[model samples]
Target: MIEVYTDAASKGNPGKSGIGIVIKAGKADVEYSFPIGTYSNHEAEFHAVIKALELCKVQYPKEILSFRTDSKIVVDTVEKNYTKNNNFLPLLERIQELSGHFPLFFIKWIPEKQNQRADRLAKEGIHK
Candidate 1:
């Protein structure tokens, strides 16, 4: 299974934002960081997952995927397969659609300390 760690950050609640992702498959690993324009922190978090999944679909098609994130809200939203918040409906739908391409997909929530690498990359992206 391919393992992926992702994170996102916004300079302000709805200010400059960025996304970071780290993908590990066997002995190989890759990292990505990019600016995501202005969005809320939560929105950025969702986008990070979307970006990571998009990359995975292209690079590791038909493979099982295990994704880790620091955002509990994202994890819960994905796990439950539903979200009551209307603003997140589209984002959640996109995630669900991306996940369907993989034979198996799992999303886990880790503490902030455990997700430092992706967090740092996300912070760096904010200035780009």
Candidate 2:
């Protein structure tokens, strides 16, 4: 199983943002951080999940993925397979499309403290 921890940070509500993803597969682990220019916090969160899944599809295509995020909105939205916000529909669709590639895909909401690593990386991304 591949365990992925993801987070996103924005300097402002709809300002500069970045994404952080940490992937752990058995004894191996990898970290990625990238600046996403400008986006809202929710948008950044969705983007982070998308980026993590995209990386997994390339590196661990056939493996099951267990994704963890600190954003309740993201976890709940994905779990329900639906969202009321039209602005996020495209992002949700992309996530659903990406999830289809995995044998199993699961996302859980974690506390901010539990997602510290990803949080730090995301902050780093904001400055970059």
Give TM per candidate. Answer: 0.98, 0.98
lDDT tens digits by residue: candidate 1, 1-128: 99999999999999999999999999988989999999999989999999999999999998999999999999999999999988788999999999999999999999999899899889989988
| Total colliding residue pairs, candidate 2 | 0
Q: Tens-digit lDDT track for model 2 on 24-113?
A: 999988999999999999999999999999999999999999999999999999999999999789999999999999999999999999
RMSD of each: 0.6, 0.6
Model 2 steric clash pairs: none
Runs in model 2 deviating more than 4 A are none
Looking at candidate 1, what is the lDDT of residue 103? Answer: 96
Query: Lowest lDDT 10-mer window, candidate 2?
Result: 81-90
